[model samples]
Target: MSDPVDRPGASGVPEAVATPRSRWRIQIIWLVPLIAVLIGGWLAAKAIVERGPTVTISFETGEGLEAGKTKIKFKNVDIGVVKSVALSSDHRRVIATAELTREASPLLVDDTRFWMVRPRISGGTVSGIGTLLTGSFIGMDVGNSTKPRHDYTGLEIPPVFASGVPGREFILKGADMGSLDVGSPIYYRRLQVGQITSYQLDPDGKGVTMHVFVNSPYDKYVRADSRFWQASGVDVSLDATGVKVNTESLVAILIGGLAFETPDDAADDAEAAAKTQFVLFHDRAEAMRRHDRIVDTYALVFKESVRGLAVGAPVDFLGIVVGEVVAINTRYDPVAKQFSIPVEIHLFPERFTSRYTKGDQGAGGRLTADRQKLAQTLVDHGLRAQLRTGNLLTGQLYVAVDFFPNAPKGKLDWSANPPELPTAPGGLQSLQESVTSLLAKLNQIPFGGIGKGAQKTLTDADSLLRQLRTDVVPQARDTLAAAQTALNSANGALQPDSALSQSTSDAMTELARTASAFRSLADYLERHPEALIRGKQEDKK
Candidate 1:
């Protein structure tokens, strides 16, 4: 090929050597495009190696989510960003696709939790205030599982407590949720130690099951016999004892809360395990009350009014309260044709036995037989139930079971459903009966007849007095006047200057003169004879 080219080039100057065109050459313009392509390929391969795992989170609403704008955070540090937000095929939820960094890849586990960070106020707590100034972001709570997950359901409500917080969870079974919500404080001796986490209606629908978390130190205090009660507000009670007010704390008063305490008697009980189940009492009184294992129900039939007596009234034995009235009913006896009041009372025999004896009370059957025999013996010995006024101001009545030695003899009706116990008249009712009997006796007296007889006698006495004043008084006055005139004449005749008194004195003097003359004549005649003249001998002397 070189010789032919040389021969063909003969037309040209043979001396001029025509060299073949150069096969290859470098151009400056092409180098620029080649370098650009090589750099672009390298960058794409690096991006594929460094990219993190993608996750999709379903939310009920997409309120604060944005594509290419919203960020995913863990512990306030950005770990990922939302790539897109789209509705699910069913349109029931919003699906957000987020791209996390390579470092966060291992954190995407089965139990990882996510929630939106926004301003919230609940259960006496304020959170996420900083989110108001900054924007809302996706919050992540790392899980403790090795298995990874690419799909998750976001929580609508934020957790009351964060993961890794030193605490324990417990279950409380309650009749109802009494003013309680998530984040309500749980107190121990009025100190906040925990908070309620969640609650749900029981499957049986009989009660609610609540979940609560207690911090580390306080969690140790929870024991097997620990008592729990609702301490939502001030528990104010006005009863026979007096007015009582109970509360946990001011926070409990504002929101709602629960309180727990280990009873002093049960201080040695074993510590409760995590997720322990407990019964939530309505109040502390019920929670603290000692449970009675043996209960005896009896019916007391009273023949009097139970006006002031009410259900729940204490049934007192001697000075001790042994039971309470469970029910009160009016019953009519068709056979006897009489009405009576039957009060059903639940008596705790253990209360009576524990005061005198200790140890196991007895087996159920034997215990029941012993109680029946004891009750019969007591009834035979004049043990009776009576109603008495407990509070005069409140007109509250209570059952008083006592020994009434003089009470009429009666027997218990053991065949009755709740074995009937003998009842005596109420104290006030006895007093009323005595007063009524006295009034009835007084009413039986014939006061009208007595009054009529008295009136007749008084009329007769008045007539007799009038007759004396009209007839006897005038006759007696006339006789008295005649007698007074005669007395005056006799007095005048007996006076010293009267003529009869002077003539009597003169006659006495003339009789004395005559006797002297006679004595002188006799003396002269007998002067010679002798003694007859003794009167004359004095003259001789």
Candidate 2:
């Protein structure tokens, strides 16, 4: 319609004058708003990407835990934020839903566990308070465990930290639980390398199971052929020595520690499955197989008391601890019609195998395998059972193996079967027999004749005393009267105030001193008869 230039701005004056400036203004107005919208969309995408995925971790209690506040930590660094906390379908557990950053997603392995961090009593565990201020989440540990990873249920009490390792699980029965304490050290060759993990009573409530864990590398050192004993609590005693025990540390002596030893014959299988965790001093099955010798046990049955016996007492084969008494039980034997106690004895054949063959086949071609030859060698080398006293106060007896070359061998079968030799006599039996024997011997003596002779001697002495009284007393009295008459005549001749009175007083004092000396000599002789005998003997010598 109108002119082309007049169409612009619809002003008749000039269309070109306002056109450039107006378009510039319009472009400037729309550019800022579009740029702002694009920036907002980019920020939303970045936030979603940083948030990563939501994972659910279940827990028993959420006491110190807060949803949307607590963070999941890995290696002491914050990695994720907890989204929400809600009850599971059972309503018994709390499930913490967490959103982790994409950077942390790769760290979440199958073995990852989630446990709440709070201030604990024994040692303060402080965490998540930083998250409360910074609005960040806690961290978690994620890695493959050597042992199968178990889902964590919140601990009612504080849980102890333990690293999982591959090892056989053995239950040690009949262990003294009070003697074993948690954190007590376990020794291999007197070197402490492990600690007791935990302990609990068995289901049957008859025994205690001690959980011991050996750290890696050292775990391989412990084989299935290991032997264990309470190294710290064992006691040894001697009559003269009194009680002797090795007590190095107060903690070891009081708390009691475990010891493990490897045998010489143990297989050198390096690839064998290591026993990283084992129950100490229990599990006899593995221990028995590891020991290559048969234990010899003897039941010492006696009608009378045997002297010197005690538990932890040794049964010696030539003064070695071949075995010990495991138990003492009493039963009435119908055939014997007497109550007999069976003392269980255990013997380890490894100690004596060097001298004797194990099997019955006399070693056929091998001289080293003959049992009879071994028995003969022992007898020829002067092997004998010597009765040794164990506890003098308890009167317990132990039969000690001794070498007696000159001792007479009685007529008994040493070959047919090892003869049931005598156990050293102890207890009331020895006292009863000794008393009975003494009484029997006393009955055999001629006591009646001896008593009559003593009575005759007394009668003769009495008759002599009567004779002395009748014959000697009158004559002595006459002599004394004559002496007194003579003393009076002499005194009268000497006169009252003469030098003779002073002389007489001095003479009487001298006589009294002599009598005192004689009394002292008699007392000394009576008190020390041995001194007199020794003086005479020495003089003769």
Candidate 3:
């Protein structure tokens, strides 16, 4: 705190001193703009760094899309926004340009999927309802591919299921698509477990192929021996057991669906790999049929009408289904001048044979020679095939193979391409024959001659009754009058009065004396007769 002392110098009058000011000093007012500029620069750099890539999506139509309004979302989270919407050069499609967040950049790969989401109803499902209020948006499904892409195709229809869902895909080949469509339910034991993703007609135009997805953990149930069938509507069947109604679910009955089941006795329960191919049977019954490698094909020639029998009818051994009728044809026996129905059947011997193996086969998947011999032996023992009524109400018939001990002896006609198995008349046919024979016997009766003879007998009886009324009746009347007269005379004579009464009294007195004398004589005779033999014994008193 000391004050500076100035000493008197050479110029005492020049005491004033000059102090220098730095030119580099900034004004306080300028700092405000300078700080503002620095912050603005940093924000610009951040915007550049966070900016994502722009991509174009081609769609069939831009029905609900708008530039700068529609958003691209992944799992309901906004990931991008549409920057522009325009038509393609050919005017056949629409192209939408969108900007996605930087974080989503990695997901835009070769297989990434994009689609417009809006309220939609398909395959018995109602979805995207939220879009009805919030407006439509683009849905994105990330791909696993590493290759990046800038241009992509947008799906017109929303996927039945999203990517990353735990499941396995499968392909079903069938004669027809039936009632199936995208998003159609796939059922397991009547429970919905997945959906059909897509379908296409085969290149050769012979059949259809469908792709389906079964979600976890149900997917694990699909096995190599699994059978898939169309369970779209109410399946009604009439058989010997009576009418049966089956349906997978109410949904399936309305919108069509498919079902799969692995047989309990399936030789293989190994899980089927993804995209494994399977046959799509028309119905559960066909799907459930055993696929036996060793089959014995035979032809059964039936002499009677086969009106109720149909192809695909079950061939039964006892109560078990051992085969099915494959083909039915009519053949003419020129030598015998007769027409017969030849039914071709495929019999799976394994169905009836214990522990039969598929390897035990002869040429053309037929029964082995030893097995054929065994079949011949069975035929020798009266094994026969007969037509049987399966459903009386429906008049449906099926083939029944059984051992009829009384069946006539016959041999297998091996000369025929498909060996002919001996056949016996069906019970119905036998009944018809009996009825026909009885009718024939009834027709042979001499009913006309019997009617004439009865008429003659009736006429004769009528004549006899007329004669009795004319002659016998008058004679009987006269006889009755005479009898009445005789009765009157008897009444007068029997009266208890006059001389007859007096005479009767006297006669009675005389008869009593005579009776007493006779009695005495009888006693004497009795005693004398006894005495004659040995005199009467008197009692000693």
Candidate 4:
């Protein structure tokens, strides 16, 4: 006992106090952490349950889209948020991961479209302008189908009209699209009621095919035979009507537009079908006049040189254009064995048949009958084809159709399909005839014989002049000189004391005495009343 005390060195006042072992018991304080963990797990499960499916949208660019910030909207109502944005493997597009709410799950269909919304200009209008201030968001369009989808491709441009817009579509075929761009207005009598949805090149590449949308009410006015024209900007045309400035409105003059008008005589009962293609005229006049006139073709054989005549030359009737020369081809007349130039002219009637009877084929038949009757009447009226001068400055010739009273009496051969018109002497023919007549008159003169005679006459005249100058002149001079000498001698003989002067004085005295005696005898005879036939009565004085 002493050794154990020394080893332990126990210096206790009381022996070991016996204590009971404490039993393991549940503590309410530990349950606080467990309860908290359970509540957290439940909250996590509820959050996951409400969150909808995640979709991946591929876009060409992620300009304004940001992960964890951008929201997806429908009609401006946010329904989803972007989760992630990363470049695709090929780097051609940006892969956008978005989480859509459960309520929008049904909207994600095969035809659903998704696109990042930013301020953009489309169809000449501004849209998504609100995105400029607040921020950009994703836009979604619901599809008609019910099939759900997780992937979508974006639209480059917004649709012309949303799914709710009500309108009908039509197709217009034109030579060219002109200035009618996308969103160009469609005018009905200067009032805009529609717009151009799209345009593309025709399948055959010959023209442009425009996709047009005409709103209701206005579209009802379109008839089967209505005219459609491109009202693009301003149309300035010059014709007999003078300067025509045509524009539907100021807006049309800017961006361009489409216009339609039904002719007054057009059938109002027949309506144009949807997508029924119509020719889009560049001008309103052409559209209105397209089907109004009837065209007739005729061939004329001409013998004159058609050098100045060309295709597309006008065929005028009384200074009015009635036709155009389509072709000038050579033809051989077997019976005459002569090659002649045959001119084919396409004639549109000067006046259209105004009144058309009811029924489809009726109008056409009546038109043909009227044309045939008119042709017969014209032929009887001496309608003749001739080549005449059109432009004097250009020396261009055109075919002239006229009623000639002096045309070599001929008849039109209407038995042919394209009625053969009668021909007359063209301007060139008359000119040639005049030239030939002039040449014949010139050739009739015997120029050589006349020249010889003239030559001989001139020689004789020269000889006569020489004879007068030499022989006749010298002889006359000699005769004149001899006469003068003789006269001078006679003058000298007749002087005062010459013998001729004395003889003259004696003769004059005797004659005077004889006269006195005669007078006295006559007086005696008068006194004796009948002094009969006495030769002389002498009186002594």
Candidate 5:
């Protein structure tokens, strides 16, 4: 180097000196590599920290989802990325491996649900327009429940939107689902409180079961004594008057819904224990009671067809819906050579007992005077089967209950004689039989003889009318002509130039002059026409 420049070193002696240009060159070479190393390390650490757990989400279809484009979002914010997608072994589902970031790990709860957000159209809502632009993605609902969880199976079909309500699960067995729809509101004591969640046929496919989710607060009001009914849909009816019913509100009338009602004797303790996840129908105690009731129902058997009996058809103590038809079955009566359909009716005496009775038994199991009154009502107005028409055209018949004043007032004597004829014949079958009998009676009438008699009567009437027109009318006309001829001759004789006319005129003039003298005579004659015959009553004048 030239003259060892005075660049200071650690040893203060002029060691192998470097120029400013060379030093700058050395810094550029060494610092560039170090900074590159630092940048690489930083990138590696970021990648490791951001990397998340790999979860395989199974879906029935991947029509709108993409591997790299689709993201896993929690609450509308992206928290994971889908790395790859492949079909499962069964090929029924698309298994997508998604990476959930470490930051989002805490949000993964046991009850968290994952569903793919796709465009859907339902009753009134059309959602997922954003997916059209950025592509559809899997949505994750991370919950805080402590329950255990497993791999999520994303629904191909969107889950029905149901409000998470605190209620007990009730299984309404043998319910009709075609009679129910979503948003079909549920009623509690006639007050709308919730809606039906869903309805599906039981796995065994014997009956339909309705899944009704009652919203919080109101859900607690349901009790074991609660009864459900199909509250919506058009119920057309016709009687002696023509067709009549309330058929407005087209949607409400068409889409039937379920309603819940509780009896007055519902247990409060049972009502309070009802929580978010409580199951009402599965309780052993409640099940036992239902079983006992079923057993009680089977004890009695009727000996006739209760065809066309409906689900809510009443079993009246008097004239009320104290109970309903639970079921109907047909069994062959070998002696009668006919099928006898027995209707299983359910009764809740607690509902009507209070309304009609009074007095109480003091601390004893025995009933009081009120019980006697109730017994009398049961004896006089106990359940009676009456004929009812179901459909006019179909001629279906049903058994109904009514308290007719003429009905016998005593306990039903099962051993006594049955009615000789079907009770009163009020149903369609009875009407048909009556119409047939009337037609038969009409057929027996001698229509040919009546027709011949009617023809003879008409012929006689025609002959009488012709005789009146030919003989009587002609004779009357001849008499009128003779009178006209006599009047015409008299008019001709009174002509001005005739001799009779001159003599008549002179006589008329003389009569006019003597009219004053004849006035008294005329008045006297008018007063007494017979006086002229008796000679003028001059003495009386």
Candidate 6:
């Protein structure tokens, strides 16, 4: 080799031996793999530190979810993203794998609820429609508990109180669930304040119980004696004040809803506790009937039929409603064996009576004593309960309490479970009885005999008139003609140029001539011997 350091030895060129320079001789290809491994390891460590709990959710459908795209949200804020979606083992549902951010780690808990938010229509209301443009996503509803967890079953139905919708929940029980459903609006007065969350038939099968939510400020209006009514559709009433129309709102008219009002002595400022049960009425009028909460029960035994009178008929005191009929039953006396209607009514004196009284006793005692005293006074002054016609067209009946001084006397019975009040006949019943009596008297009249006698008398009068017209009229006409001829003769005799009028004038002239001769004789005699005194006055002429 010519020079070892400068050798082209493989091709037979000269090799040169010179000082060998040491080099940093690691392969860059191997370095690339090493640097990639270090970088990947660091990334893996960072990912491990940052990764939140992985949750797998089973859904009925994978309708709106896409791997690496779909995100979980709470109150419109993003918290996690879907990593993968696959069919469940049984192929019945979709199992979604989601990677939650570390910040959302605490959301997984026992009561934490999850559900897919999508456009849905319920109770004539459109909701979640905003998701149509934004694409569907998972919704996480935070729970009430503080316990940290990592697994949860998603809700099929949306929650009523979403994230921060401030409100309290209550249950309403009614005889029937009429046009009410989930998401039905709850109204205070006529405003849309809250919604009906859920409902179910009462376990005892007595009624339907609905779970409702009353939102923030409006919830404070509900009180212990607040009246809730189904303010749905149109309510038209024809009463003494003519036709009346009542509706809560246009929304309530279209889709059914509930409305509430503080009626009696319940507080308005203090809120009723959550889950407090209330009775739901069919309409506002029905709810108002129970405004006076306290009831003083009384019984009235009516001898007449209690037909057309329902249990809810208004019990009025001098045209003002003071109570409602609770029940109507028949009782038979052992001795008389007569069945009489015993009407039980709840008399709410609180409607017209105040809690404070003359004495310093507690309200309860004062109310009791006042009621007793008033009852005794009423009984003494001939107070009685009677039925009256409320609607003449429908013949609907109502209970009326009034003083009847002319009523047959009866004593009150306070020892009974429901204190017994004296009763008079219903106004309608009395009217019917009077009409029946009149009909009976009418039936007793000899109508056929009267008609025959009237016909005979009419015929006799007709015959008499005919006789007068034919014979008597002619004879009277002849007599009147004779009298008229006599009157004409008398008129002719009194005429200015008639023979009788000439005779009378001649007689008057002869009398005047005789008088003149007598005057001449008297004048001669007076000249001689004051002849026969009175005759001398004619001499001056």
Report the number of the highest-TM-score candidate: 1
* Sliding window of 10 residues with minimal summed lDDT for model 2: 119-128
Q: Provide the RMSD of all predictions against the true structure, rounded to 1 decimal.
A: 14.4, 17.0, 11.0, 13.1, 14.4, 9.9
Per-residue lDDT over 344-369 for candidate 3, one digit per residue giving the tens place of the 0 to 100 score = 99988766655456664333234343
Task: Give the lDDT of residue 70 in candidate 4.
Answer: 96
Sort order, lDDT high to low = 3, 1, 6, 4, 5, 2
Can you give the TM-score per candidate against the true fold? 0.64, 0.52, 0.62, 0.58, 0.52, 0.63
- List the lowest-lDDT window of 10 residues for candidate 1: 532-541
Q: Write the per-residue lDDT of candidate 2 for residues 1-541, one digit (tens) a residue.
A: 5697657565566534454455435656788989999999899998876766667777776665677778777666777777788888999988777777778666555665566655333212233455444554344655565443323444333223433454332334445664666666666666765666667887888767776666556666666656665656545556686776654245556666766667677765342253333445632233434443344444454554333455656667755665665655666879979875545555454556555545734443343345445545665666554446666687666656556666555232454332333333443555778999999999999999999999999999999999999999999999999999999989876885667877887899999999999999788778767776675333454
Off by over 4 Å in 4: 1-71, 81-99, 105-117, 121-124, 138-153, 237-244, 292-541
lDDT of 1 at 319: 91
Query: Taking the tens digit of each residue's C-alpha lDDT, what string does model 4 give over 265-361?
Result: 7745587888878889987877886363567899988987898899989888877777889999998889989989989998775343333545564
Report lDDT per candidate: 0.89, 0.60, 0.90, 0.82, 0.62, 0.84
Clashes of each: 0, 25, 1, 0, 0, 10
260 in model 6: Cα distance from truth in Å? 3.9
Relative to the unseen true structure, what is the C-alpha lDDT of residue 453 in candidate 3, on a scale of 0 to 100? 99
Q: Candidate 1, residues 1-541: lDDT per residue as tens digits?
A: 4665557556665465788876687778999999999999999988899999999999999988999988999999999999999999999999999999999999999999999988988889988898887788999998778899989999998888878889799999999998998999999999999999989999999999999999998999999999999999998989999999888988899889999999888845998999999999989888987756678899998998899899989999989898999999999999999999999999887666665444554644455559877788788999999999999999989999999999888787778889998899998889999999999999999999999999999999999999989998999899899999999887877778877677877888999999999898777776556655453355554
**lDDT for residue 508 in candidate 6, whole number 0-100:** 93
Please rank every candidate by TM-score, starting with the best. 1, 6, 3, 4, 2, 5
Error of 4 at 221 (Å): 2.1
TM-score of model 6 (CA atoms): 0.63
Candidate 6 lDDT over residue span 1-541, tens digit each: 3666564575677667798766967766798889999999999999999988888888888988899988899778998999999998999988889989898877777678888888988776777898888888999888777887665566667776775678888989899978777888988868888999888888899999899999998888888778888988889999998999988778777778999988665545466898989889998888886465467999999999777899889899876788899999999998997889999999877655553666744665555558867677777788889888788899889898989898877776778888898987776678989999999999999999999999999999999999999999999999999999999999999998999999999999999999999998877886766546554454565
